[model samples]
Target: MSAQTIKGLTYPYPEPPGKGEWIEMARGVYWLQMALPMALDHINLYAIEDDDGWWVVDTGMKWGDTQERWKLLIEGPMAGKPLKGVVCTHMHPDHIGQAGWLCREYNAALYMSFGEYFTARALTQEDHAGADWRVIEHFTSAGVPFEQVQQMGRKFRGFGAIVEPMPGSYTRLTDGDSLAIGGRQWRVITGSGHSPEHVCLYSDEDKLILSGDQIIPRITSNVSVMPQEPEGNPLKRWLESLAYFIEQTHPDTLVMPAHNTPFYGIHTRLKALIDHHRGHLAAIEDACREPKSAVELFPVLFAREIGKDQLAIALGESIAHLHYLYAEGRLERQRDEQGVLRYRSVDPDHCPYAPADLTDEDVPMEV
Candidate 1:
């Protein structure tokens, strides 16, 4: 496939590897692809051949066919490489779903951040026969009809359904932790907003990074406020994470993302992600001219029609943007008579996404 360039970023690999196939990114690093049932149809997995064995990064969901595929992969593309360990970027089911089965199959240890491991472990044990009241209340407060909310509560599912049982112990990976694998030294860098302590592996010598969901080339990772933490400002932390990447990463460094094709121009991609969210925040703030429920502003923030399947996430992202503007003092929130929470612009003249201070050159003229 011929690579295409857009927006100052270069996609060196124009097309992703086909199912059950692998692409060698470097001498000992390989990219693997798997199918997903979600709106995003595929995920990219990475494998690094090390001295002892091969370490797999981010296992796909625990589908019924996954085990057979892994078996075939071991004998074929993996070259019968003995498994080293599984490195999970976060607690998300799509990333860590097969970690346990893979580790047990290879008798390898599990590597994850403490927060991710513990949080995932707890989720695996939850029995949500009915949805948690907090979750129902959180959605209701955003103007979701009681009937729809009740229906959600009835068919609630927990993480355990998709995830295999976790191993009893794990090796914790924190920010700045250096790991030796496949002759490359990978430094673990942790970021938040998508999930707690999302891990991104960086090889400074090779000028490459396994960016996980933190720096995907196309879609911006979802930064949400969970039902448990409704008042949190995850967008603030998300923006800061992007700023850090833009400042710290070199423009030429290659980015291997979890869901998109590998590419270069890390600086440009990171800034573009920031600008995308900035646009969302500004539009949402302006839409709050009159008091509006989070559900009501969905039209301003999202382009597609949201159905029942998308309700939870739709509400989450809406509240995430709303919370950011509210915390910035550009929007004020209150509860209506129906107990639905609504937000309105606090200062009509204020720009929610503007820089904190304006220099003389930035002052507006009658252009």
Candidate 2:
């Protein structure tokens, strides 16, 4: 990928790390890139040097090549010293997929937020029978065709396929916790919406932030309401989390994110993400001038085509926008005779709940 330059942010690395090579990002911090077979083809992992060993963050999915790459890393640049610990940013497979394997291999402690850890455990438990109707039911309720629901159900991806069996328990990394690594203290900053209690590490001494998926330079992290929490307002939580970051961090902090090249201008990026979602919420409200199902708002909410692979996530995000508007009183939701959920604009002239005049610092707390 080409180098990314924003207002005050600069991506020093023009290209990402190759198959078995790692890039030295700073004095003691190393960057590793792992392959993923998806629209987003890669994830960035970090290694912070410590007195005993290196502190690793964000393992890639449980793919065979990824395992091979890990082995190579162990014998190559990371020789002699062992892993001090493994810190996962969230419950997503690409972030914690190989946590079990890495921790077991290096005898390192797995550190993550409780919400992410428990949620991952719940999803990885495949003992339950039958197809998981959580997603199917969610789509069905959104006015999706019955045949489409069945098709999606048959191809529905689960946690086990991507994430390995998690360890029985993990060392919890709470918000405001300080982790001492390589003679520097990295404070844990937790955020919600992308995933519950996602951990982002910040070091004032180093002038850097390890932003997992909470802040990505290229794409906005998916902030959709999942079936697990049907009424969950993830968009609101996401906006609040962004507000927190903008309030707490500076504009020049170098961000080492999970997906794109590490860059500066964190406040700028955070505002962009917040603005992007607010724009979506506005589009959804306008599209709901007439009663419309979540699926019907896709064209207005998303710029590209919603293919089979992207349908589930796209629908969830669309529903999240609708739910946020409904909660904000900008839209009214009702169940049609067909049992499909429909949303209509509550008031065109007066939208008391609409998040207007949404300056980065002035975002409503209710958002």
TM, every model: 0.92, 0.92
Considering every candidate listed, which one attains the maximal lDDT?
Answer: 2
What is the per-residue lDDT of model 2 for residues 1-367, given as tens digits with 9 covering 90 to 100?
1013345566888699898988988778889989988867889999898988988999999975988988898888889999879999998888888999999888889999999999888877743333466656677789888787776544454568778789887999999999999988999999999888999988877778889989887677787877777788999899999999987777778889998788877888887677777766766777688999988977776656678777777777888888888888788888888778999997755643333322222211111
Alpha-carbon lDDT of model 1: 0.79
Candidate 2: the clashing residue pairs are none
Kindly give the stretch of ten consecutive residues in candidate 2 with the minimal lDDT sum. Answer: 358-367
Candidate 2: list runs displaced more than 4 Å: 1-6, 127-135, 155-157, 351-367
Error of 2 at 13 (Å): 1.2
Candidate 1 Cα errors over 4 Å, as ranges: 1-6, 352-367
Alpha-carbon deviation at 309 in model 1, angstroms: 1.1
Pairs that clash in candidate 1? none
